[model samples]
Target chain A: MLVNQFLILGAVLFCIGVYGVLARKNAVMVLMSIELILNSVNINLLAFDLMNGGLEGSVFALYIIGIAAAEVGVGLAMVLLIYRNKKSIALDELSEMKG
Target chain B: MLASDIVVAQNVAFGIIAAVMVLFALRVVSSSNVVHAALSLVMVMAGAAALYILLAAEFVAVTQVLVYIGAVMVLFLFGVMLTRAKLGRDADLNNKNWAAGIPVALLLLGVMVYVLIDGLGDDKLDVTSGTAASTAAISDLIFSPYILPFWALSFVLLAAVIGAIVLARKD
Candidate 1:
């Protein structure tokens, strides 16, 4: 398989994720978009790892997965708190800090 | 031509999986229902694990399945339920400026695709080059030269746990 295939796929996913982050209103949707971006980065890393014949990219990918897990935990917790306080998860209503 | 045949097969598999993943990713961003979008994200994650396997990163692929699909997705669903989001389609799930995101995403895609294709050309992945890293090798690297990052990651995980509890508690 050509490396371009994987790289292009990653680029496409990353672009979709960027759109998600910018356009989505719900906090959970934004978090899911971030996952898309992270997965795209992981794909790029593993593709380069395969090309270079090294395990570094794999290790980094693992760390990324770990960090993503932690991020999801804290992100969901924050979203839960926001929902609890405001009775909604819409990002537009989160203007308490928009002074 | 046996080697070429193998490459051809791999290419086909990659194409199919990529297509499915892209479709699910689109749904993840475009779906109006919160639960539907989260479920689509799960599909995308599973597809990503398939791609990782194709790249010969079996350990990472399994970890992706276990962590992202298994744990993170559950957390997302829990958040959705706990938030009491609408179970049906939501008409205003997007912001008023949502139309602006299209051009931005398109421009970024154009730049990234141009750079990748221009720089990499037709570089093929040498799958049969015996460069696949075994699980033991990955662990070895993690515990040896990459030990610092491993420790840091553990600390980060711990902090996240405590922080989550503190933030979500009903104090």
Candidate 2:
């Protein structure tokens, strides 16, 4: 398998994720998009690990997974708090910090 | 089996998995219902795990399934339910200027694909060259050179758990 195939797959997924982040008004959807982005990065890392023959890339991928879990936990908590305050999770309505 | 046959088989598997992943990823972004989108994300995660196995990272593949599909997706579903999002379709799930995101995403994709193909043209992966990294080898590396980062990650997890509890708790 040519490495380009995997790399291009990563790029495609990453761009889709970016679009989701930009276009989704719902906070949870945005968080899901971020997961797509992270997973794409993980794919790229493991692909390179295969090409170069080392465990380093997999190590980083594992670290990324761990951090992503923590991130999602905190992110969902924030979303819950926002929903509690505003009764909505729309991203565009979040203008409290606007100055 | 011949080495060339193995490569051919790998390519075929990669093609099928990549196609399915891309489709599920598109659904993840475009699905109207929050729960449907989350379920689509689960498919994408499973597809990624399969691809990880194809790349000979069995450990990461298992971790992907266990952490992403097993734990993270469940959390996402809980977030969906707790946020009181409509279980069915929601019309306002997307931004009003969602069209603008398309061009931006396309531009980024173009640049990335061009760079990847240009920089690493047809570089074949030696899939048949090496054995899969043993779980023990991965653990050794993690405990040896990567021990510091591992410790830091633990702290991050600890902080996240406490912070989440604090943030989500009722007064």
Candidate 3:
């Protein structure tokens, strides 16, 4: 397949992720959107690596995966904490500090 | 099989997998149920892993499956369950301005696709090229000049663990 095909796929995924982040009211759903964006980025990285005949992109992608795991861990913990305090995980409902 | 035949097969596979991924990604965002979204995200991740394999990044593809599908999705499921979100369709799942999202997403997608094609349209993915980064080389890269970042990533994970425990703990 042409490198352009992968690029287009990644772009489409990223756009969908952006829509999710913008549209979702549930905090967990937003986090899932972020994960989708990260995955799209990984696709682009691997595609570029293949095109450039280098392994650096794959290594970078590995690091990105680790970072994403950490992000979800921390993010979910925060969501749970919010749920505990407010009994809800809706993003709009937690706007107490919107002064 | 002949080389051209293999390329044709890869193109077909890529088309099917990319379509599946896009569909599941839409489900992940549009679904009213958080659990359903998470489950569909798993399919999206799996499709990405398949794409990685097509890119000839075998080790990276394995890591993608192990880390994303196995660990990350499980973490999301745990979060969804522990949070006790309502399992059915949610009426208030989307924000009031959700309609505004469509044009913005389309604009971004259009810009990116244009840039990518204009910038790298001539370049082709060398599927029959050299092998992907070996585990040894990856480790060496991690341990050499990138060692500091590696340690920093560990610290980040450590911090996340501690922060999670502390934040989620009942007062």
CA lDDT, every model vs. true structure: 0.93, 0.95, 0.90
Cα lDDT of model 1 by residue, A1-99, tens digit: 688999999999999999999999999999999999999999999999999889999999999999999999999999999999999899999899993
Q: What share of the true interface contacts does candidate 2 keep?
A: 0.91
DockQ of each: 0.88, 0.89, 0.80
The total number of steric clashes, by the backbone 3 Å criterion, in model 1 comes to 0
lDDT of 2 by residue, A1-99 (tens): 688889999999999999999999999999999999999999999999989999999999999999999999999999999999999999999998993
Q: Could you report the Cα RMSD, in angstroms, for every candidate shown?
A: 1.4, 1.6, 2.0
Best by TM-score: 2
Question: What fraction of the reference interface contacts is present in each model, in order?
Answer: 0.94, 0.91, 0.82
- Comparing 2 and 3 by lDDT, which wins? 2
- Highest lDDT model number: 2
Question: In candidate 2, what are the lDDT values of residues B1-171, reduced to their tens digit?
Answer: 455645777788888999999999999999999999999999999999999998899999999999999999999999999999998989999999998999999999999998998999978787777679899999999999999999999999999999999999999
For candidate 2, the lDDT comes to: 0.95
Clashing pairs in 3: none
Report the error of model 1 at residue B106, Å. Answer: 0.4
Give the candidate order by descending TM-score.
2, 1, 3
Per-residue lDDT, model 3, residue B129, is 61
Ranking by DockQ: 2, 1, 3
Q: Please give, for residues B75-112, the per-residue lDDT of candidate 1 as tens digits.
A: 99999899988999998889999989999999999999
